[model samples]
Target chain A: MAFLARIYVTPRADVLDPQGNAVAHGLHSLGFGEVTEVRIGRYLEVRIGGSDRAAATEQVTAMCERLLANTVVEDFRFELDALASDR
Target chain B: MAFLARIYVTPRADVLDPQGNAVAHGLHSLGFGEVTEVRIGRYLEVRIGGSDRAAATEQVTAMCERLLANTVVEDFRFELDALASDR
Candidate 1:
């Protein structure tokens, strides 16, 4: 099996996003009148191989906890792609 | 127009990824001998509306520069989703 894993990391809700704030100010200057809030995050695309779906899932979940995510300030979640699916 | 933006924020190649390293060690502990390396990042999905494609693209790009991305340590890129496309 192969997988493309996307992880989302953000400051906790109570934490302010200075980058997002700066961008919001920039948007104000750029004439995007309808925009209100902006938040920033990250994405990762991973390819993993395994003999079976169960094995792949196990491997990926472990991968996330140990390497892909920081449990302190961020939360992690992912979805599996069908073996032959196109990106 | 609507967009699903996936931002990939990774340490520069010169920078070491401790979280990724820790996960690699964990995988080694879990008996998955085939694993080699791990890297982590974040993802974001956004929805935008504009009267025209050009306007939408302009707004989205501005959004990325002004709010959605941290240019200092991270690189940002995004793709547009057809307004009616399914997630």
Candidate 2:
């Protein structure tokens, strides 16, 4: 099976996203008034093959935890789009 | 006001995303067979104050170019979900 996964990796809410904040501040400096906050995150689209949707989901989830996302300060969520198993 | 902006910053099609490739290789190592490709990107949620939608779009576009995205290697698209003007 092939799937289109949209993975979002965000700084845990309790963890401040300084990179995001710095960008926001920079925006303020560039005259974008009242830019309050910016939350930065990562997105990934991966093509995977599995026996079934659940199996693919499991594989992708493990892939995320092991390599794609850092669980310490970042949180991740994925939306799975099951495509025909052509490839 | 508040907005939920989904910003996608992806490597230009011609540019290689080594970090993404590395992660995919790691997935293969971990037994997610036939995983073809992985493209990584950045997403952002921001809060901004603008006179109107057009103004907000312009401000956010500028923000993406000046600070949020690396135009040389990356291409970005943003979806703006406008909220009520209470804030």
In terms of DockQ, which candidate is strongest?
2
For candidate 2, lDDT tens digit of each residue in A1-87? 578788888889899898888888887888877687788989898987655788778877888898888999989999988878774
Show the lowest summed lDDT stretch of 10 residues, model 1 chain B.
Answer: B1-10
Best by lDDT: 2
lDDT of 2 at A70: 92
Report the poorest 10 consecutive residues by lDDT, candidate 2 chain A.
A47-56
The digit string of per-residue lDDT tens for model 2 on B9-82 reads 98998998898888788888887766888999898988876547777787778878987889999998898887
Worst 10 residues of 2 chain B by lDDT: B48-57
Give every collision pair in model 2.
none
lDDT of 1 by residue, B4-87 (tens): 444455555565667767756776787656555556554554455454667667767776667655666556666655555342
When candidate 2 is compared with the true two-chain complex, its DockQ is: 0.72
In candidate 1, position A29 carries an lDDT of 78
